[model samples]
Target: MVARVGLLLRALPLLLWGRLDAQPAERGGQELRKEAEAFLEKYGYLNEQVPKAPTSTRFSDAIRAFQWASHLPVSGVLDRATLRQMTRPRCGVTDTNSYAAWAERISDLFARHRNKMRRKKRFAKQGNKWYKQHLSYRLVNWPERLPEPAVRGAVRAAFQLWSNVSALEFWEAPATGPADIRLTFFQGDHNDGLGNAFDGPGGALAHAFLPRRGEAHFDKDERWSLSRRRGRNLFVVLAHEIGHTLGLTHSPAPRALMAPYYKRLGRDALLSWDDVLAVQSLYGKPLGGSVAVQLPGKLFTDFEAWDSHSPQGRRPETQGPKYCHSSFDAITVGSHFWEVAADGNVSEPRPLQERWVGLPPNIEAAAVSLEDGDFYFFKGGRCWRFRGPKAVWGLPQLCRAGGLPRHPDAALFFSPLRRLILFKGARYYVLARGGLQVEPYYPRSLQDWGGIPEEVSGALPRPDGSIIFFRDDRYWRLDQAKLGATTSGRWATELPWMGCWHANSGSALF
Candidate 1:
């Protein structure tokens, strides 16, 4: 029965082809050869690179691979439909280090071979014809006119942001032509059937797509404002959406454009050096420099990636610091194992044990005091101190730090130079020998860079004596000298969102 079924399937193609009158075989063969040669020349491949005759074994294998690549059925025979595809021009740039490049090459090669088989049989249909081209998209239902020049200028500025990237090429076609990119604006009432609508507050202000043929859609329904009017900034939100379109997801740097919040920007405010550097690393280089820093892991397992939406499963685990007293090597929390440095080389990473203690649940923040060798973990709106190796000592509650109104995702940095401990969350605090107190440090422009209304996930002291803070997807640096002299300190440029907590140096070997 299986043999009979296979025979019938094989004969089905012949039955269909039998209906078409055979034109002079010579005429059909000549046309096929000419078209195939043209495609090879246009795509910069030698004629010999693609098999000319259907019966050739090399031709059969090439066509099979091409068919498989394009997601078509793998039939080794080179039909007329496939032949036309073999003739079309191919435009693909190759990069050895790029994962995207490798994926695209595999797709292109498969499409080319599949086209050869289709063209041989003259089965190429209009929509089905293999066009060795990237996917194209275009904007639809764009506004005919803007309410004000400010809005128009802002839109142009957003487009220019991605266009200026050295690694990205923005192509604009005639108004009626197809485009590889599309931009659209929808009123708050418009819904994409996916429940993604811009309600009055906290709904999506805008969303962007990935590189190939992606569209950026903004919800025009919300009342757009310039600055932090009523605590919302349209320019800030638009800038962030633009960053998404440029292939940057949300980062933990608070001041970064990719931060997941609405921010306001002035007309003069453009991409900072850090912003340019980050985007350039992904797209290529501006004037040309090294690529952005690559972390060891494919995904960050820090606190930020924790999904509150997940039903209580096993909590993600982390190991405590391991010490090498003999080598004077100490591994701090949040440090990953990296290559060995010359004199300060820190060897392999020792994993921490995961176990439950009779302590409070929902611990949101933690800090280690190197001076006293005590680790403090915060949960339930209070701080608890634990001592001994691996924090296995009896835990005792410390004086409650009362500034935080809510449980905060926090970071603690011990500044050895200033002999002070800095606790950062929605706001920055200093813990000295006396007690915990809110530092008088604020951004120069109190209205623009005042208290953080959200929890901070990370903090570190820079070599330059400035404090660096990391929030959702942005990073900000506070200069100590500037903070002392004026209300606001110098803000270092934003860094990429690496994880909830990051460190410049320090590691431990097992």
Candidate 2:
């Protein structure tokens, strides 16, 4: 069915990096016309304009169309209100698809009273959409502020925000694996197109490819955050991008999550009625008996205060690695684990292969059971349980058998949950500490923890009962009370036990 173009309706402001195309504060008639022409052309309101009389006529008509869709006076003149509206932050996607989608959608809303099934049928034929119900996505890389686990949780929850309301299911593909969709972070021009290049920080925060292409790009320069109103909210932006991947256009509804401009996560549901109806039109109602999942705005608002937390404040012991001035040439190539005592004394480096007979070298992640006091070591796909350098019998089992990831990013005996938690990408696994078995509802999305990132080296359970995750030269300290990262910095300097502190410095630099 060729859907009829319905009446023009209101569409909220959409994404455009106002930074890349800034205008002087003062504007003359020519300036106003120039801005209007660019806005109309960029958003699909008008065709290319020239000095011809016909072009002027179309330009005036384009002004009226934009004014009408924006719910302003449709006098066909570039009035003050219309000029002000052009400056609003919006989605970078062309408005051409959105208006057409909304036109069909409005007609469907009207037709639903007489025929509901036909509404779905006609709208289904509109344009491009993924044929498969179950889709997979991979995050090629992410921002530095939040770790991979936390970022995964946010993205997973955003995807769930849609799948809950539609007949869709999404799973994150493994790194180095094929995926239907791939989300990545890039700064400046990483070569999608010059027009689509991210304009650092405030402007053109991110953009996504329409369906089947299945790609979304975020500006690494932007301060992308989850749960908080500060910085560009990554959760909100990714939700909007996820909508586009599911063949959704920018929404015309004021409250829609697909609106091009940034909005803080509110206390109510993330997906507006318009947003839900748009996706459902293409995918139909969710299959099976599950009810729709509407995440509360307060749920995001409560993802920890991202507290002004300081580390547990311990000074380096007098005896701990007194090589503050050691030359870089002293560093070895092989990985080594050294036990740092409570008084900050560093033990002699011990190789994993030497400490445990069966456990191989280069342990990926390790966690000591707070309950059993059994040291757990993970290498590649095999796991080893040890007690005082003695390997337990029948212990070098496959991680897959116990429901743990082959090589997890980090592992810790989470003090708050009191379970052995393992982090990989966007999902985390909980193991029965004693048996080392993945719990019943284990290997769940990391969205609950909300902001841990990928490729972290190790996790340390601190004496004060907090968890500190190590990645490169940095470490993120997870607040046990709130279950979120409160403080993060270089582990060598922030943590005195790591033994990289300057001997003469008595206080933290920050």
Model 1: weakest 10-residue lDDT segment is 321-330
Superposition error at 298 for model 2 (Å): 2.2
- lDDT tens digits, residues 146-252, model 2? 65666776777778888999999999898888999888999899897777777776657778777778988888888776645356778788888878787776766
**lDDT string, candidate 1, 448-499, tens digits:** 3243334444455455576555443334566554542222221211221221
For residue 272, what is the lDDT in candidate 2?
86
Worst 10 residues of 2 by lDDT: 325-334
Clash totals for all candidate models: 35, 17
By TM-score, who's the top model here? 2
Alpha carbon lDDT of each predicted model: 0.41, 0.67
